[model samples]
Target: MSRIAVIGAGIAGLTVAAELAAAGHAVTVFEKSRGPGGRCATRRSAAGPFDHGAPGFEAVTAAFAEQVQDWQRAGWVGADAAAGASRLIGVPSMNALAQQLASHLPPGASLRVETHVAAIEHGAPAGWRLRLLDGQLNAGHFDAVAVAVPAEQAAALLAPDASLAEAMRVTRSDPCWTVMAAWSDAWAAPGGSWTAPDPTGVLDRVHRDDARTGRVALDGIASRWVLHATPQWSADHLGAAPAEVIAALTAVLAKSLGVHLAPPVHAAAHCWRYAQVPDARGEPCGWNASLQLGACGDAWHGAGDVAGSRPDGVERAWLSARALARQMALSLTPD
Candidate 1:
């Protein structure tokens, strides 16, 4: 069995770790965050908890459905038919999915969270040595390693290796801004989902009562709402003051709904610097056998082709991870 190190605890990393472990390979996952679910995350407020990262996941493919079924069986996820359309969400929070995937790992399967990988070096034995941000060094012999971070972050990690760095350099990603709020009362929306063909210079998609997960429910009549800003707008206002952005989004939301809604009882803004794949490669996934590094994300595969063109970022990332895992498994024992 190969010793594998999967970088980043996002869906891609989690999926690959599970696949490798299922194949009897020794695998470990390294994440810089405090918990799993890199972008597919949730946040808490006085009102309640809401998924400020990935809104939800869509099960469009047989593979995705099978995984969801497995998750449901494991009690890590729950199925919901929103407006008669099927979707899956984490039981308590979105991160529950990642937590469940991490659960089945072998007793000693290492998951290093809050540990930053500073640099990676190739050893004489063709293994990897990781230099962490805290100056703590961890070296291991691995038959292969997969990098499942954003293209930019991946590029930085592989910079010492010329070819691998070059491959990552070709990959690019964009940013996004998600504005979350809790209203005093449920506001009537025409549909469950609303998209602006031409964003009104502030918001891209407006979702009403979107946080349907059971983890944290909005109290009283107040419900959860979200406004996703266009990538262009997010980029332009990447460093703008948070209060300013919140004010702008609140005003736009009020105008769009044609109601003088109170300033949200709870307001927050999330900036996804590398939110989604802007220019996804035409391949299903990428691997550098020599460097023992692979790169995959929703952007690696055509974003729209993963599930639908509607931009379900988490589901797309999951699809790319699943495909990459299958490929990695095959590579382990080539026929």
Candidate 2:
């Protein structure tokens, strides 16, 4: 069995790690965050936890569809009764899916959270070396390394290898500003809305977390809303103060609801520098067989809707990770 390293504990990395482990490879997954869940992200607070990133996603491909069915059976995810019977979300919280996937790894496969792989380098014997954010080299070598970080971040790592660089040459992702609003009582709009499209042009979509199938308030929080600003707005207000972003978006939200909305007891704003790739492209995953280096994530492939449009955030990550894992597993053998 080969020793593999999969970076980023997001859905894509976790998925690839799980697949490689199932293939009998010894895999170690690295994550920078305190736990797994990268934009399947949740922000924990005294009032409650909010899925500040992608609220949920669709299972378009059959492979992904079957996996979703398995996740459903395992209770890692469930159908979003409000969005439709098809839209799927992680149970309990958006990060729960990552947690479950991380736990499903085989005996030799493992996940290391709070560890950041700052850079990747070539090394003999181990084949690859990981330089961590702490400026320390990882303990050993990895026969193969799969990167599943944001495309923007992956560019730096892939730059050392020309073929890998060319594979993701045209990939781009936009920034986003998301706001979370929590209240002790349900959001009091004219008629309660599970979701609302932006009327003020300052936002993209607004959703109520309480309306989703399996969300219960924590502490004093009984109601929650997630507001996502348009890319243009987010870019325009980039690096703006959180309190300012909160005020501006909430005012727009009040206008959309046509109410003199009382302030949320708990509210905050978060900025995602690389949020979505509306036009993600390239091969299913970037691979350099000669280097045994590869990359995958939402920025890779998988766009097979009737209109040829890609599935939203989470599914794209899953698609690319699964494809890359298959490629790596089949080709990997003991030297």
Candidate 3:
């Protein structure tokens, strides 16, 4: 079996690692965060589990849809986020999906969280050496390495591959500002549901976190709201302090709802620097069979879907990861 190391434990990393492991290759996933699911995140606090990142996602492609169905059957996904719609969310929290995927590593496969792989080098005879952020190198000699981080971060790691580096340079990621607030009182929800996509003002999406299915219930009338600002707005205030961001968004929320509303008991703001690409070129994944090195993520996707309805960012990540795994498997002999 080929020994492989996947950097970044986000959806792409986990998906590729899992697929390779299932194909009889020994794979190990490395994540820089305390947990997996970079954007599929949830912050735990006294007033939380706030879905500050990737509130929910949709499964557009048939393959991803089938996979989503499997996740639903396995009790990892539910449609409570968008009532009567196919939009699905991780049960309890968005992070659960990544956690679930990372948790189920069969023999010879493993996951390592909170580990930062600074760089990778290909020596003449020693194979691939993973350099840690702490100046130490991973002891294991992996036959292959996969990079599944955002384009900005992947650019440096993929510099040796001129084509991949150019692709990364072309695929630029934009920023986003998200504010999550919680209250202990009731508020007027839009049409009795708590959501507004492409509504009227500076916001792109406003969702009621607690209103989704599988979330822990509150005793009295309460609300957990998550507000996602438009890409332009987020970029304008990309470096704003969290406190200032929270205050600004809270006011915007009140104005957008056209209600003074109850004061929030908890509120916080998060910035996603690499949130999306305004124009996704839908590039194919990177794989060098002779080198056994590869790269894949939302930045590298080949969405052949119909013109009008292309796959979203989340779906692109899965597609890219799966494509990379399939290519790698084709190069390796099966047991």
Candidate 4:
């Protein structure tokens, strides 16, 4: 077994680490945040918790579907009937899914949260070296490295490697501005979830998290909603202050509801810089044999979709990580 380093503790990184560790390889994951879940993010507050990133994702392939079934059995995830019978979300919070996946990693595998890998320094006498954000720390001499971060981030980390660099160039991602709003006891929510298809649009969709998961609750509160701005709108106001974005999106939400809504009891705005990749191309994952460097994420491969219907996010990450692990296995041999 060989020692390997996987960067970013998102679904992709966690999948790669778990699969490699299961194969008897010693693996370690480095994550920038305090916990797992890159875009599968959640924010907790005195008001409650909010899944401001991805609401949920579809399981396309049988491999991913089986994983979801396992999670369901373990109570890590559940079907959101309000969103759709097929739609699945992490219980308690969206990050719970990543946390569960991280927990299932093999005994030899370890996760380092709140650890940022600032740069990758290759060409070491032993193997690749990781330059962490903390100047005093160092990690290196791995058989291989898997960078399972966003395409843009992967590109930056693998810039010294030509093949991986070219592979990430084709993928293009967009921004998203989201608002989490909760109603006061005085204002009753209309109920249910909605997806707006208005041609003259400022918003993309709005979902009732309370209906979907019932994970968030505040005293005297009836319902909560996460409003997502359209890609175009998000791009136009990408740099706008949070208050400005919230105000404009609230107006859009009012227009969608066709009702004069009262002020929210609680409201917050979050910006996702690399939210979605509308157009992306390349292999399911990329690896450089010479440098033993690789990358995998939902942004890799073709339009990360299932039968050209559902946009593959969580499932795609799983598939890409599996592919990378297999490649790593083939390249590394036991001592």
For model 2, how does the per-residue alpha-carbon lDDT over 228-277 read when each residue is reduced to its tens digit?
88888999999799999999888888887766767889899999999998
Model 3, total clashes = 0
Query: Which residue pairs show backbone clashes in model 4?
Result: none
Residues 138-197 of candidate 1: C-alpha lDDT, one tens digit per residue: 766667777788878888887756765676678776788888888777666554456754
TM-score of 1: 0.87
**What is the lDDT, from 0 to 100, of the residue 110 in candidate 4?**
96
Give lDDT: candidate 3, residue 47.
Answer: 81
Distance (Å) between predicted and true CA of 334, model 1? 12
Query: What lDDT does candidate 3 reach at residue 180?
Result: 83
Residue pairs with colliding backbones in model 3 are: none
Candidate 2 lDDT for residue 157: 73
Which of 1 and 4 is the better model by lDDT?
Answer: 4
Clash pairs of candidate 1? Answer: none
**Model 2 TM-score?**
0.93
TM-score list, all predictions: 0.87, 0.93, 0.93, 0.93
Model 4 lDDT at residue 184: 62
Name model 4 segments beyond 4 Å from true. 134-137, 186-190, 302-311
Summed backbone clashes in each candidate are 0, 0, 0, 0
- lDDT of candidate model 3 versus the reference: 0.81
